[model samples]
Target: MEHTGVVHKIIVAGIGPGNPDYLVPAACKAIAGAKALVGGRRALAQYAASDGAGQHIMAVTRDIEAVMAFIQEELHERDVVVMVSGDPGYYSLLDAIKRKFPSECIRVIPGISAMQLAFARMNLPWHDARLVSFHGRQPERSALLYQKGAVMGMLTDAKFTSRTIPLILMECGWPGEAKLHICTRLSYDDEKVVTIRLREAENYPEAKNGILLVEG
Candidate 1:
């Protein structure tokens, strides 16, 4: 790829949970000097005035092609920063970005994931938990993960929530008596953490950013 007499650069930065407080110094430093910012709408809004000032802002949507085009255009002139929610290594845009740009030209700065925040808020060690994401997937696909008794961390979405997920797990063999730790809007001022049995989760509403802990 030809650049403006400069090596093409792309920084895949993990912006952490929604709150600015959770953003790590390394990621913050990279964003400070970014020429173009590509991330979800919420992330751009969070840093728009500070790190995103005078930078080309592009919201990543279902259109992956458009995002790649925008990044490429920016790369020809200057470095571009592609931000992802949570740790870039997790179920994020890191893999897609890697395929679009050369590995040598890309640098990744990891940040705290919502799941990590969820575990932290609940004061539970997470290494033993079976983690899953139902962001754009079906629970039935990961049927084997719903063991009768096990520690599980699930990253939920609008379609999948405490209202729906707990019942789905129960149908997949999880016991109704199992505890559900519903951690929502982590790292933000409005963050909420609640505990209830899996059977009683129907009363809770959906959360755009939430993690559900299914503890045995």
Candidate 2:
């Protein structure tokens, strides 16, 4: 048989908000079939222990160019699964993947986002919410969202922890009396969700893995 190169494929999979139960069946199936997997170290840790044995897994390098290069090289032989922490489309790896690979060569499998879960916990509708990401950046536009009276949903990281959000809003002249709905370490054993005044948030102890629901 004359040898022709394999038609490499990539599945941009969202594994959900740090819980195995939240992982969709389709994503599980795609991951099981992948020859190579790529994502953040934490996300890979969760998947590697459960569904990633026998697959070549790679962590996203600090230099995005390196990560992209690895994927490009691997895709020449087999399919690669890029695991994103939440919904891949929301403030996630989707943009980078799309830029490197053509849309026709990639398939996206959606997962439950932390924002969706946080809203569900509050029993509030998010259709009208203004979504923002303070993952690695400051919440500069958050003030505008507050001024417009937009119900806001935000994804936060170590830099913009739960405690810091209130401080930023306070600096932005947001009223300290307004209520903040915060969900921290969601879907984990230590998950906590509470609605408290903006002023109270300044003293909160646990500030990691936080999602914020701020009423504008």
Candidate 3:
């Protein structure tokens, strides 16, 4: 009974950005060997990700409970891989994964974040940058962007877009001279990056989803 009680670990692999080229070997290995796979549609779309051996748990806000239940049932059977976008450390599903499963039963494999890629695309260093997300969230902490020297990388959704973020910052007193880099569809063939001043954001093209970098 003691031998039978040993449960297989749940592997949480971070699938970087949108490109398969950024996937790390360890993450690929985990996905390839998974007996059960759980993640967003994009994450689960990998060729050998599910392999028809187990269930597909869609990692959406509405299906969270069902996803957890699916994972719990599969965790003890064999390899179970949970994929997340970017690194598990950032604004990803890692937090929910931790809440649903104990530390001992979970293992995280890191991958590149869009923020990291955005900074890279700008040919700038990001270790000193301030990162935040406005995706499906309110910009309540606008005060955090008040700093005079710190660079900022904001994840914007359709609602809080590149056009509005700059205005929001200016309303909060972030000066008009600050440089804004709109990095859209990063790592894709159609990926675009444009630089402008914070004041110019209103005139910039609308961005559905991407990072808006604020540099001093």
RMSD each, Å: 2.7, 3.8, 2.9
Q: On residues 38-141, what C-alpha lDDT tens digit does candidate 1 reach at each position? A: 88988787765564457798999999989989998888778888889889998989898788777878889998999998888888898777888888876555
List lDDT for all candidates, in order.
0.82, 0.80, 0.81
Cand. 2 Cα-lDDT: 0.80
Q: Looking at model 2, which ten-residue stretch has the lowest summed lDDT?
A: 139-148
- On a 0 to 100 scale, what is the lDDT of residue 41 in model 2? 92
TM-score of 1: 0.88
In model 2, state the lDDT of residue 98: 83
Prediction-by-prediction clash tally: 0, 0, 0
State the lDDT at 4 in candidate 1: 40
lDDT of 3 by residue, 1-216 (tens): 122354788788988997999989999888777667777866666544434665544554567778777777776676678888889898887788688677877799999989899999999898888778888886576535578787888898989999988888887778899999999999889999999998988987788689989987
Residue 43 local lDDT, model 3: 63
Candidate no. 3 TM-score: 0.90
Task: Indicate which candidate wins on TM-score.
Answer: 3
Q: Check candidate 3 and list the clashing pairs.
A: none
Estimate the TM-score of every prediction: 0.88, 0.87, 0.90
Worst 10 residues of 3 by lDDT: 47-56
Question: Which residue pairs in model 1 clash with each other?
Answer: none
**What stretches of model 2 exceed 4 Å from their correct place?**
1-6, 49-54, 147-149, 171-173
Cα deviation of 34, candidate 1, in Å:
1.2
